[model samples]
Target: MLQVFVFNIPVESGERIGFSTTLLLAITVYMTIVSNRLPDFSYLDISYLSNFLLSDVTSGILLIICVIQSLRFYHAPVMQQFPKVWVPDLIVGNPYGSNINLAENGRVVQFTNEGEAVWQPANVFEMNCVAQIAYYPFDMQNCTFGFLPWGFGVKDLFFNVVSQELMNIYFSPNGKWEITNTRLYSQIFYGDQLLRLEFTFKRRSRYEIINTVGPIIILGMLQVFVFIIPVESGERIGFSTTLLLAITVYMTIVSDRLPDVSYPDISYLSYFLLSDVTSGVLLIVCVIQSLRFYHAPDSQQFPKWVIYITKVCSKWKQKVSPKDKQHINDEQIVNSDDIHVPTASEEEEREAPPINWPMISGCFDKICICCFTCICMIRTIVLFVMLTM
Candidate 1:
């Protein structure tokens, strides 16, 4: 007797359909709320956006899987009714594709291209359990080695229907294994058990070192320039400013490369922070020097020779103090305003050899000029060397 029946199936289970609608509605509401609160890219707002994107992607993948599973099951009865034919359609190899069996075992189960068994096994020991599977090619001590067995798990591998019982054996000399597929290139693991994958260590190239350490060294050198230059003069400020600009550009590049992860130790950010502080200090010193020099008078209030003679006398005094001296040297300082030179009227009456005060003034002027010129020349040479270096 043949039986015929007609049945209608629901497109989606009631519970699943309701849940999908509810989840979509909830996400929509959440997105709306997020958009309302965080209008701009404030740090807090960016976090919300990131979370939203991740959540949406996860939900979308879940929904797609659910839809695919539903469609696959809808055609289940039709597939079950058909008998399997092993014609070895090389164009479409296996029903489950290459992933049907572990690569360690050959995929040809019982058939060949001509629908005949090449060699029939009479009660051949069948592998009914998988103790472990691992993917390995992991770096041990910075060296990557070929994959070794890392994991095994207990799994029931179905044998021929005629077999009586499965024997849980540990090791066998005649155990046969085959590689179903070969991966052209991948991070090889020791074996397909533990998830440890390894890669070979490559020697650090000069370009890599330059990219990593060059900026810091260059910036450090620039800072040394500012440090050696005297703050009293204006050169330090200009050099510091240039360094600051360089750091600013470096900071921008660093910020672009670095992710949002916050690092605790000295990082690129810390370098820029230090440079900023140093630049600020140099600028402050420059301002002070400028003010000091701006307020300083061009002409000396007292005789310039007094300042020069006092410095020379102080050096001599230090040397003489260390030695035993009997004479008490008396000294007095006379400025241009205080000098009492003889007038023409006073000189005419003097019978003794007349003194020329103007000549004395002229001699002091020459000495002062020479000292000033020497000081300028020395300072100029030092400044030039610093700038060039």
Candidate 2:
């Protein structure tokens, strides 16, 4: 038989003491059960059991709790109060032992115990990107994303890039850009240690070449055809003006698609701009040439060189046979039925002119054709060099 003594106590105190006693009893029972299930000491592997309990079971449980909490309260804002817990700050001589993982919103940093913590809950981010466009449709670019602890000094936390392969594997491919290379680096920046990831990408030229460059090249080539139209047809100026306006509209569209950068490395756009200016100047020259040919009086005296060139260009003209000349005279007589025939002195006056205005105009057209052909060839060569480079 057992004798028991009971003491009266406050309700809250008794509850707390009972709860503590119950927890101790439960732990003792668990240990006894685990010990009974174990094999004899001579046959048991203590190292395996110790590892399983400490590293696998305990750490796994804690990791699971961390993941769940992170997901459940990911949007919660964290605040820190003054008089914070002090941590040691130290710089890392080597970063091989650390590990880094990139998250969607930020980076996950794991440091070895060799370094001291300068501060808690710091953030570094990538926000600025500058693009080079000198090559235009076929250009390459390098961009960087970096991070460093905000409040931690170099001594408190060491920053380093653990893996570039992770970034390369996760990078998404796009129609306009192709990833070429990825690199990881670490350096001290403004007294803070910075870990940087750099990505190099090249522009895919197929889309731009097919959609933008092809049409522009065709238009540039067609500009040469404007000079092919006869000056007397009254369409030369109008056609050139229309082509100029079309080019201007296309330029505006291209400009709108590009970023507002001071220097876009694309040579194609500059080529187009230069082509437009050249076309405008060509049009002006054509207008002047046409005016000179049409408005010049038959009595106007041309330079000796001009007369020679005109005569040479007109060599293809068939000499008038006597029979054709007679026919021409008969047609003139019939058209002037009420007019008296010209005297010898008047016929001699007409024959005294050395240069014919109509012949000189025809020669000018031939010269324009040759000049425009040469310009087109030069433009083609330049474009080839630019695109290839």
Residues 1-389 of candidate 1 have per-residue lDDT tens digits of: 00001012255543444555455666667777777776555663466575865577467557746755776676444322212332221111112222222223332344343444432212212222211111101101122212222233212121122332223254343222321222212232232222122222323224423663356445644453343444346565567666667766655655564433343222433443354545445554644443443344555253556445544444444566676756644674446798689987574356223223332233333443354345435433543343234
Model 2 sits at a Cα RMSD from the real structure of 16.6
Ten contiguous residues with the weakest lDDT in model 1: 131-140
| Cα lDDT tens digits for candidate 2, 227-326 | 6677668787777777777777778777776776775445566665567657667765876675587669977778888877776665434233322433
Runs in model 1 deviating more than 4 A are 1-193, 200-205, 227-236, 263-389
Best by TM-score: 2
TM-score of 1: 0.27
The CA lDDT at 3 in model 2 is 7
Q: lDDT at 205 for candidate 1?
A: 28
